[model samples]
Target: MNIIDKALNIFAPGIAAKREQARTEVVRQQAVRKVTNSLIGGVGSNGRGYGKHGASTTKSSMLFWKTPVGDADTDIHQNVPKLRERARDLHMGSDIVAAAHKGLRTNIVGTGLRLNPAFDASYLGLTKEHAETLRSSIQREWALWADTTKCDAAGLNDFYELQGLAFISTLMSGDVFALMPSKPRPWSVYDLKVNLIEADRCATPPDKVNIDRERIQSGVEVDADGMVVAYHFSNRHPGAGGYSLSGSNEWVRVNKYGKRTGRVNVLHLFEAERPGQRRGIPVIAPIIESLKQLSQYTNAELAAAVITSMYTVFITTPADDEGGTPFDGVGMDDEDLDGAEDVPGATGDEIKLGQGAIMRTDPGEDVKFADPTRPNPNYEAFVRAMLKQIAAALELPYEILTKQFTSSYSASRGALLEAWKMYRMRRAWLSKTFCQPIYEEWFVEAVSKGRIDAPGIFDDPAIFAAYTKAEWHGPSQGLLDPTKEVQAAVMRMDNNLSTGTRETAEINGGSWEDNVQQRAYEQTRLKKLGLVQAAPTVVTPSEPSNEGDEDNDDEEGGEQN
Candidate 1:
């Protein structure tokens, strides 16, 4: 070997290694530069450019900025109609939605209308003898007006059912309107009828008369003080047939009917979500996306189950037996195109494909079946979580919403108690907004017509307030453990923590005075029938004896022995 050839070969390997290292270094430097540029340029790690002012660059993030911002009512005014329509559709289409409404109605108003007269009899200048007479008189007059036969045009059972319907309407629509109009009756002391108006009937007045001063928007006219002065109602409901965009659909301006003392006659029932929100958003608005997703998930699960049940059977035949029937001796028929016919060896009855009928194949043919597994294991857990979120958004307990109580007793009771708090608050709001106004108007009419004997009814504001004071009773939330609850109530009363009046009012939603009167009447009837209920007697405990007294007693016993 030549020495020069050997040296050249050894150096060639080293030169190749150096070139490879240099190339790698260049690539590494380029990568570092690119990463540095991205970091300094406010770009996301994913290579998407940053939004303006370093916001997220994704389309979803940018879409949030497009949301409108303004006063609550103004922002939602145009969308209210659409929201109501969607909410109604959801309520009708979804079982859970319907169940929710039904449960709320049952809890809020059960059985019938029960408003107890709690008027201050002494303040009205009536003696005890006259007080009972006056209360009964007022109650009878209220019954006359509140009876379904006299009050509602649509023939609901009574005012109680009307209240329930109003609640449902308010939930479906953003709000509901009730118009109190007087009618004439020969035998009645006062003729007051309640007309329920759909939200569609009230709209921005078409005439637009003095819009600058009236500030009329969405059928409601508000004054400088932000109080509703009048309501512009379409002659017919906007949703009614024959509605047109022409000037033919005239708006009737009904001056806000109320007393001179700032009590409104037109009752609008809705729960406001914001400080300046003039109109309500549907209860379902906040959870609509979740509801849609849940519905889709449910439908997908059902579809999967159906697909899994569909078993496909395949029959293989010999290469040369294309014209032969799979069933051995059965011949092909022109009439049985879909292959629904009795086979030769089978019973004479027709065999349907999906009705668990046995299939007969040729001796050498192979039968293969396809069965699909469906309904993912995570489906139920995922659905349950989604329903919980929906219940939260609706201000209801999950158990209450789904009507499934697999929870512990304590947990279930806690949920029920918490739900009752919200229910009570809503009930109070409904009564204040809807029931009280109607009662006040009725009171004024009854006093004017001399049906109720309240002296100085018009002169003094204090008299008006005292005479109009009433307590509305709804269905009782019966105790889960009646014995324990009754004992606790008795203890509370004995300890002066609560009064009989309050306890009576809480238990059955009845007035204490009314209950006492009813009990007295029962006792009178029992006396007439010579049947007496034994009164319960309380025995006081004796004090413990001292040790000396016991010894003395022992000695006396020994002496006697």
Candidate 2:
């Protein structure tokens, strides 16, 4: 080193170190630039602004934790058991949680989703009368299969009731499974029986080794293409059933589709929220933490209120001839006190607080009243707020979730309508994933057995879909104002916007054709009784329509508590 540089380093070591660090940084940048320039494609646009938004690594402490980019199933596989457990726990323990699931079940598949058979006559090249005949035949056969004695494998519930159970289970348990294992009944012609398997039973066996290249996750066996090929269903529920079958574990690996027939054997019913998500997330997963917190808060508040409501009396005892505390600061047992009633909440002390309750203390003791400032003034508001959050997470309106419709007519109706949207969506999903497949399978069996006449169904997928293509109508959204709703329905019908058949289903969940035939029979019987009257005049669209009274309380009135 130069004499002057050596002297400066000894005198100003910090300045010399700073100079060397700057030179090293310059060299590092040059190396980075050279490597970057060699690549055919440049680095992501402006480094994709990775230091902020979505996944961040900025100065903010909140952005410090980095999330992995693993596939959906990989992330959810380990967490499934806990998620399902908590969901079921909530359903069993919390009334609000149970009500959420119940509301879904009621609104989505009340009674059951009724099959409205719509046979495609155009492609099938069948006459309208022929189509109608086919529909009637199918409906008759469907009724026989839907019987409680024949439809369910256990014969516990009819097909309609099964629908509600399965859908509710799906919400509470993340998913549900149906095994279409047929066993013929002595009297029933249909051998198709639906056996619902709990989500817990359908999972990879405990002793399973990676023998095959296929990945088995949460009971679902997926191929290299990420397509679910089969499900491993244990004979016993893994969550409850003992994991043993005569000393060895057993699991039935049911294929998604039959080997030769291509019919789906195991129906894995779940709503996939992400691509490659092999299983469903419980409906309340997003709100689990909030639910737990709110539940705890509610419990704490209730306990506090209860404790505060309790009235305890402390009397000062007279000491011989001086003033002092009573009972020697010891609690007296109920057996020692005559005419003493046991307190509801008090332990080791007498705290009975009945109306006009008279307490006889020791002589010279004076009574001191205990104040119970309880029943929080803000309790209702806080509970309502929490319920609103939970309702939003559940995709239900607050009024619908709580069944507290003490609002204006518009508000009540709006809440109902909003809840119906979610209900309808869930119903459609259930019908598509659960009901339709089962029906199709049942129909296929019926066709093969010569119970129903069909041509080219097995050969043509289109014809098969058309024949099986049906609409499921669950419970109708009941009217808030019957007269107003009826008038609106009539108006739409007069304008050719809706049909009587559709209106019948929407109004009271009935088949218009069935209603018409029933009406006709009733009219005939009435005429035979000689009680017939002149037909009511039909109101045409050109006729003047009556406007609703503005003074009526229809707009603001709502259901009473």
lDDT string for model 1 (1-561, tens) is 366546645878675666668878999998997888677774544444554434554556564665446776567766788888888888888777788777877887665536777788777777887888878888888887786456664445467778888888888887998888888756645677677888878887645744663367677788888877888788777677888745568777777754565656578888877765566778888777778777777887896686456454666766655664444335534343254433337654333344243466666778878666665878877887888888898789888888775554455567788889888887887788777788888888888888878888788888888888887767766776555566777878888999776677667766777688898999999899999867955433334323233334444322211
> Where does candidate 1 have its weakest 10-residue lDDT segment?
552-561
Provide the overall lDDT of each model, using Cα atoms, as 2-decimal numbers: 0.72, 0.78
lDDT of 2 by residue, 1-561 (tens): 567657769999887778778879999998887677455233332233442444344546645576777777667766877999999888888889989888788877888888888778887998888888898989999898885558889988999988888888889878889989878888878888999988888877666645553488777888888788889887776555455633545778899899998888888788887887888878999998888887888898887776555455656667755865555424544444544445667675435443344556666777777776667778787888899888998888888998887767666778888888888888888888888999998998899899888888888899898888888887789997776777778889888999887788889999988998998898898899999667966643453333332323653454333
**Model 2 root-mean-square deviation:** 5.3
lDDT score of model 1? 0.72
Error of 1 at 111 (Å): 2.7
